[model samples]
Structure formats: C-alpha cells, structure tokens
Target: MKHKQAGLSLIGLLIVAVLLAFVFLIGMRTVPVVTEYFAVKKIIHAIAASNPSMDETTADIRRDFDKRASAEYVDSVTGQDLAVYKHGGQFEIGIEYSRKIPIVANVSLLLEFQTDAKSNGGR
Candidate 1:
C-alpha cells in the first residue's frame, strides 16, 4: 500500500496571490477617490448650511466652494465648477470637481463627482 499527498500547484498558488494583490491595489487606488468625494460632499453641505444670501447668480457660491476645496488640496484639486438651480423658495447647490488620476505615464483616470445640497432659507 502507498499514500500520496495532494496540494495546490505552484501556478495555482501564484494565480491566487496575484489576484489578491490586484484586489488590494484596486482598493488602495479607490480610497483617495472616495475620500475626495466625501470631502466635496462635506463642503457642499457646509455651503448649504451657511445659506449665503441668494444673489442674482451662483458665481459667489461657486467661487467659495472652489476656494475651500482648493485650499484643502492646493496641488491636487482641479476643474472646479458649480451646478446650481432654484425651485421656488428652495435652492439647490451642486459642487463639482474633476480630477485626473495618474495610472501610468501620460495615462490617467478622469474622475469627476458632484455633491448637491438644498437650503430652504435656513428653515
């Protein structure tokens, strides 16, 4: 009688390890994007809370949002704009940010996100 042990082959183990490594890398890369998105959301909420007097246009809010985000990430934040609209007495403010993620030389991932908040004259 003879007994033999079976185990994962080198290639099989290597493949599993590579797959795990890839998942970890993707998660790491996504963390910053998620963080930036949340930060933008917070900024939008703050702007809405402040409830700056509604002006003839949304330029002031846009500039203020850009200034805040820019100060937070002077070197990273790019493409700042505002998407604003009003509904009767309520106003909705949307802060948008477009950023480029460098994946390789001259290759980037264009990531953009917007956050919207509504204000009812501080009610």
Candidate 2:
C-alpha cells in the first residue's frame, strides 16, 4: 500500500515538471517577438518627431537618428526603407522592421512589422 502511494506521487511530480518545462520553452520563444515589436514602435516615434516638416529635407538628421535606432534593431525581415513626408501642417514618418522566427535550420517565420506616426510640431 505504501509502495503504491509513493509510485502515484512520483508520477504526479513528473507530470508537473513536464508542464513547467513546456511553459518555459514557449515563453522563451515568444520573448524576442514581443521585444522587436516594441523596439520598432519606438523608432517610428523618434522618426516622426525628428522630421517636423516634409519639405524640410531632413535626411541628415534622419540618417543620424536611424543609425542610433537601427543599432538596436537586429535585422529587417521586410522593408528596409524608412520614409518621411509631410501632409500640410503635419509630418508623417514610416518605419518597418523585419522579424524572423526560427522554426527549422532552413525554414523560418518571416514578418514585417510597420508603424506610422504623425505630429503637428507643438509643445
């Protein structure tokens, strides 16, 4: 009777351990995806603020900013082109980042995450 009880308890412990391991693996896989999404969003916001006027020809300013921001980015999965333009009094900026998930040695999950932000240049 004691032996039967000990066997059941050990099996229960093993099941719980396996479940925890599975959850840990999933969390690890998802962390990079969430991180890249937010990083890209931050870059978009910075670009929008830096380019106040579409006609201002702010490439030098934007290039410097992109250099700093892109350093935080790993690599692009889709659009590498960053664009800035103006619509009347508002400034528009576009940023895109590519994200890749490794599923196999030769296959990957590729996605392009893009964001646009507009501002009217104010306090």
Candidate 3:
C-alpha cells in the first residue's frame, strides 16, 4: 500500500511567503496615497456642498480649498491645481494629481487620481 502526503513543501512555502511579503509591501506603500486621495475628495465635496448658492468667487473657492487641504495634510494637489467651473447652475470642483511611490531600488509605482463633484450632489 502507498500513502500520499498532501502539504506544501518547504520550497513552496518559502515562495508563498516571499510573494505574500511582496504583496504586503506594495499594499503598505499604496494605502497612504489612497487615503490622501479620499481625503482630498472629501474636502472638495464639502467645499462645494457648503457653497451651493454659487456665490463664492473662484479665488474664494481656491483659498478655502487650500485651507482645508492643509488641515487634511494633503500636499500633493493644491488649490491651484483645481478645475473650478459652473455648469447647470452648480459649482463643479475637480482635481487631478499623480503620486509616485518608490517600492524598491530603481523601481516605483505611479498612481493617478481624479475627482470631480458638484455642489448639489453628494459623493
């Protein structure tokens, strides 16, 4: 009679461990960037929502965005980077930015983020 053992070999286990480690490392690098993106999006949405009357000037909007972005520790995209315009009687605010995260020697991950929100619609 022959019996077969079903389990991961040592080499297979090591390979799995290495792959998991790499995945974890990439995830760790990615989380903060994503967090910041969401924070920026929230800030823009809040600003737009609060000024639904569309009475605020573009300069005023930019200034408000700068203040809130600073508070949120979002330095990648500034108020100057925003695209502010009026459409359908609503203020539309948007931002596009790219972030580069270095993962290893001479290797990096680049991420692009864009968000647009209207004053009346909550996102």
Candidate 4:
C-alpha cells in the first residue's frame, strides 16, 4: 500500500517560514511610507476643503500647510515643497516627492508620490 504525505516536511516548513519572514520584513520597512502617504493625502484634503483659502494668497496657503504639517505629522514634505495652482476657478495643491527606503545591505526601495488636492471636491 502507498500513502501520500499528510503534512509539510521540515524543509518545506522552513522554506515557508523564510518566505513569510521576508515578506514581513519588507512590510515592516514599507509601513512608514504607506502611513505617511495617507497622512499627506489627509492633510491635502483638509487644506483643500477650506473654502476661503480658495482665494488666499500663496503665502497664506503655505502658512496653512506649515501649520497643518505640524498637526498632521507630515515630516517629509514641507509647505515650500508644495506647488499651488489655480484650476477651473478653484485652488489646487500639487506635490511630487520621493522617498528612499533601505531594504538590505545592497537593496533599497524608492517610492515616488505624486498627488494633487483640488478645492472642488475632486481628487
């Protein structure tokens, strides 16, 4: 009589464990970038939603961004990093930046984020 293997062997389990660990490490390294991206989106939306600022000057807009940056915990990009544009009679804030994350001795990850915040409820 012949029987099939019922479960994973030691080598099979070890391979699986190693793969899981590699994934976990990559996730750990990327977590901060993901979190900060959302934080940036939130800050942009908040600033864009402020209706009165639609007509505000660039200096005022930058000032508000600086304030929001502190409150929102967005450390990567500053108000000076923002580019303001007027689109379709509404104000838009555009940001383009990149972050480099170290993965290992010779490997790294580069993430680039490009986003715009429009005051007219457009993403």
For model 2, which pairs clash?
A: 77-98
Instruction: Between candidates 1 and 3, name the one with more favorable lDDT.
Output: 3
Q: What digit string (tens of lDDT, one per residue) describes model 2 on residues 1-123?
A: 355433457788999998899678666776788776777677667766654554555474366446756687734432336666666776676776666677547866666677878866632
- Each model's backbone clash number: 0, 1, 0, 0
lDDT for residue 12 in candidate 1, whole number 0-100 = 94
Taking the tens digit of each residue's C-alpha lDDT, what string does model 3 give over 6-105? Answer: 9999999999999999999999999999999999999999988786555667888889999999999997888899999987678899998899999999
TM-score of each model, paired residue for residue: 0.71, 0.60, 0.88, 0.86
Give stretches of model 2 more than 4 Å off.
1-8, 56-65, 77-85, 95-114, 121-123
Supply candidate 2's per-residue lDDT for 56: 55
lDDT of 1 by residue, 1-123 (tens): 797878999999999999899778767786788787887787778877876665635777777778878866633443245677777766688756777766547866777776789876734
Position 102, candidate 4: lDDT: 87
For residue 30, model 3's alpha carbon misses the true position, in angstroms, by 0.4
TM-score of candidate 1 relative to the true fold: 0.71
Instruction: Itemize residue pairs with steric clashes in candidate 3.
Output: none
Can you tell me which runs of candidate 4 are displaced by over 4 Å?
121-123
**Candidate number that wins on lDDT, 3 or 4:** 3
